[model samples]
Target: MNECERCVTLTTELQKDFIKKECYDKLFKQYTNLEKHFISLEVDNQLEQESFQRNNSFLQQSIPSFDQLFEINELKAQSQVKDTVIMKLKERIKSLSENLKEEKIKKELDEIETINIELDHRVTKLVTKNEHLKQIYKQLYDSIKSSCIRSKEQCDNLIKQVNIKSAKNSDLNASLQEKALVITALKDTLRKLKGKSEVDEAVTLHPIDPELLKIDVAPLAP
Candidate 1:
């Protein structure tokens, strides 16, 4: 081809390659963004799961204390009710007299006695319930404690696995360094061979001058 045709062909090829590169770059960017989006989604999901697990664990650990607090509050309310009853009884007894209407006082006393019996029943029921709760709490605590022990054991196992992986990584790094050295040696050998081949090509391409090829022979003397 002529010089002009060759130049045009080269320019056309360059434009074609440039267009291909632009398309490839845009496609690569889109692909990269998609991959990054997937990774981000996975990370978010993992974080949410971890957060939920933490909240669940914290609630489980605190359940017994909440139950105890409720029990204490109930006991306080019962004690307050008992104190009020006793104060009313004292007030009634002090106000009672032979002329101050005994029937009215007796009716009030009967009502108070009935209330006392109901209060006693309530106290007994509360005590029984408290005991039952204590037993249930103990059982739940034991189960949770054993589960924590298992989790600790699993964590220890994971640590051991991590240590083993670390050792393997060290071994792999050593092997990589040894292979790198071998590669460097091979590169040096390849460079020497290339130089030798280039010299051989140069010699083969350009023959020795006829004048330089002619040798002067010296006569052997006796």
Candidate 2:
């Protein structure tokens, strides 16, 4: 009982700083224990009233001050309101942060899309140019190849003509050499006959027939 009444007494420090909710709750819990003990003590009082009646006055004294209880309730209300406000602020900040990140991502994506478009255009132009150059190169290569083949055929024809002309020239030279040898032999035989006739004066010469002396009587080599 004395302990319960001592808790109810206000300290000078509590008067200066004002009691917080935690202190009020602790005091209130102690008060409840004291009340339960008093109820039990009351039952004992009925059994022996004259013995505990003098101690029963401490129950009314042990009740916490009403002002302290009101302050505790006010403090708890203020703390709940502050916590709610802090939660709302945090949610708002998170929302703003998410929005900023999304915007950054969207801007980067736009840049990437633009780059892709430029790259696609460049690639298309390069491919078209490459194909055009390939066609021109093919045509040039074909023309060169055809020209080379034609030139080779012309050279072959010229070589064949030269060979034929060389063969004909060789045959003509051989025929001319045979004719020169026959003419030389005939001149030598005529000279020897002329010398013999001059030495043999006793033999009379016979007259030749006109047909035998004719220009076409004997044919020389053409």
Candidate 3:
């Protein structure tokens, strides 16, 4: 047997010897208590060992494999690359939008400049036409004035002749008065033509005045 059992057997034999009953009982109780304590310690140690083994097995199962770690790293790198590409694309789009806006503004400005130039050309053409009309009207007035003056001189000479021929002819005198009225009417017409020509020149020279394409002149009565 083991040491504890051998000690218990020796104590039992001593019980029949000269040992007192109280001492023997006390010694035997102590040995029994010690044995029980050792048994409890052994059981606790066995339980601790089992718990350690189970924890070790769980740790092994929870650890990641090498291939899994490599895959996770690759995914992180790809995500970073995609983010960089997206940033570049956004910058490019912003630049293109700005350029398009500038181009549109430039196109509009060019159109406005072209319209202004066309308007300038139209104004120049109108001024040129106005100048030509003024020259024609001036020449026409001079020609009419010359013709009327000549006719007046001829009528004055005719009046002198008629007055000398018909001193008491009331009908002849009335006819002469009518001829004088015609000469006065011709003078009025010449004055009006001169005034109208001046007005047309002023209108053409003014910056904001509209072009006058049509002009009305009174016809001379026969």
Candidate 4:
């Protein structure tokens, strides 16, 4: 029994030591987890402070002072208005650009119209010149035709005159030839008659006085 008591006391002491060691281990784990949680919270707080300081520095740079704070609020309202104004300005610029483009297009169209008018005027002038030229050409053609007709008539008249003159000349030549033949025949007949007359005169004078006959015969022979 005394050994059993001693064994029981030893087991109780070992159990208590094991319970203390377990409690120590549980406390150490809790402390380590708590330390880590504290470090994370501290780091989070530092990050938040740094973010706040950065925001405060930005505000200070952007806004000048206490009165500037109110000015900033007013400016914020003005900024909203400015946004509307900027949008309106953009719209106005767009409208102005469109107007300019339209005006330019209209001007170009007017220029084209003017050019067309000038071209039309030129065409009209050319047409008038062409008409004048046509009239001149017609006059020239008519004059040439009349001159040709006159020249042809003159040529016909000249031809007729030449034919008549040729006919007259032929008739005159025929008459001259007939007259020449007649003259030649008359000359021959007169010569024959003269010879016969001379023979008869010699026969008739033969019975006359010989001296008278001799004187007449000598004159006739000469």
Candidate 5:
């Protein structure tokens, strides 16, 4: 994957880990508190039982020593009061446990909700970044495509220019050939004229003027 995709993947993994950890921590803390409360309740029950047993033992020990019937009735009354106090303590403990459970549940839900909100925010950011990256990639691709088209057009233009130059060269070569043929023909005509002139000179006219010829012949005779 590209850099942007890699980064987004890593970030998503990290967010998942963070959410898991937060949930674990919240659950662990709630469980620990619950355990502690249960332990406390157990200890309270044990202490209440021990106190009841001790009171019973004391009442038993003192019963025979007190012969007065009124004293026995008062001792009975005190035992009833102790039983009532224990019952009230148990009820209070039960109420407190229920409240603690409710509070713990509420807190856990709140934590979950907060985590969800954070996750949503992170997702939004990742989505925005992904879109932005996509745009950038598209732009780059378009630019590259345009550049390729331009390059191809330039190459085609160059080829056209070369073809035009070749055509011009061909025409110039043809014209040069025609000019050379013409020059050759002119040279041949000039050579023929010179040959005719030489022939004419050899045919020198037997003197058109006979006097001119006789002067030359007599001079030689004299």
Candidate 6:
């Protein structure tokens, strides 16, 4: 009985040691897999951290600083102000140009009116002179037609004088015709000027011929 008991005890001790060894082996294997998984996760975390740092550095380099952004905004505001000022100046210049043009037109009209008045005065003088010449020519013609001849010598002398007087009268008639034409042209110009309110420099009257002003008013001898 004692020997049997000793063998039973020894078998129990051996079985317990084998079970502890099997459990220890299984636990060690599980620990090694968990450690490997933890090491892989750590490496992945380090790589992610490095990628985050690079991205942050690139963003910092690409984005503008606060002071530079402020300067850009200031430049945009200044450009808008300059544009507004230029627009106002352009409007002001247009207004001034219109005013100046109006003034110039008024000045030209005044000058034209002054010239018209002077022309009227000159026309009156010319008309008076023409009427006086017509009267002289009529009187000379009547005197020559009513005169009676006394002798051959006196008739010949009278005929010669008449011819000379007739030639002079024809010249005077031509001059009067020229004066009439000038008066007609002046009247036409006055009509045109009256109709039109605006005119350029070409609207001014040309100078009259000086030769047309001379009148041969000398009385004819009978």
Candidate with the greatest lDDT versus the true structure: 5
- Please report how far candidate 3 places residue 74 from its true position, in Å: 1.4
Per-residue lDDT of candidate 2, residues 1-222 (tens digit):
387655664364355335444554665565556555545544543444432333334434676467755654564555555455555655655565566567557756876897699789979999999999999999999999999999989888877777666666666666666666666566557658776555345335443343432222222221
Across residues 1-222, which tens digit of lDDT does each residue of candidate 5 receive? 599998997898789668867866775666566566656656665666666567667767775454544555665566566566556656665666686678667867986998799799989999999999999999999999999999989888877777766666666666666666666566557558777566457544332332222211111110
- The better-scoring model by TM-score among 3 and 4 is 4
Ranking by lDDT: 5, 6, 4, 1, 3, 2
Q: Which residue pairs in model 1 clash with each other?
A: none
- Candidate 4 weakest ten by summed lDDT: 213-222
Stretches off by above 4 angstroms in model 4 are: 1-72, 195-222
- Candidate 3: tens digits of C-alpha lDDT, residues 1-222: 599987996787577333444644665565455455545545554555455456446547887567655754564555455455545655555565566567557756876897699789979999999999999999999999999999999888877766555544545555556666665566557558777566556444322111232223322222
Residues 1-222 of candidate 4 have per-residue lDDT tens digits of 399987997898689668756865765665556555555555555565565566567787785578756755665555455455555655655565566567557756876897699789979999999999999999999999999999989888877777766666666666666666666566556558787666556443222222232211111110
Q: Which stretches of candidate 3 lie over 4 Å from their true place?
A: 1-63, 168-222
TM-score, predicted candidate 5 vs. hidden true structure: 0.55
Query: Alpha-carbon error at 157 in model 6, in Å?
Result: 22
Best by TM-score: 4
Against the true structure, what is each candidate's TM-score? 0.37, 0.51, 0.45, 0.56, 0.55, 0.33
Give residue 43's error in model 6 in angstroms. Answer: 59
lDDT of 5: 0.66
Q: Who is ahead in lDDT, 1 or 6?
A: 6
TM-score of candidate 3 versus the correct structure, residues matched by position? 0.45
User: For model 6, how does the per-residue alpha-carbon lDDT over 19-86 read when each residue is reduced to its tens digit?
Assistant: 75675566566555545554554555555555555655655788857776675566455555555554
Q: Cα lDDT of all candidates, in order?
A: 0.63, 0.59, 0.61, 0.64, 0.66, 0.65
TM-score of 6: 0.33
Q: Model 5 shows how many backbone clashes?
A: 0
In the order shown, what is each candidate's alpha-carbon RMSD? 48.0, 28.0, 45.9, 44.1, 19.0, 53.4
Q: Which residue pairs in candidate 6 collide?
A: none
What lDDT score goes with residue 203 in model 5? 45
The residue pairs found clashing in candidate 4 are none
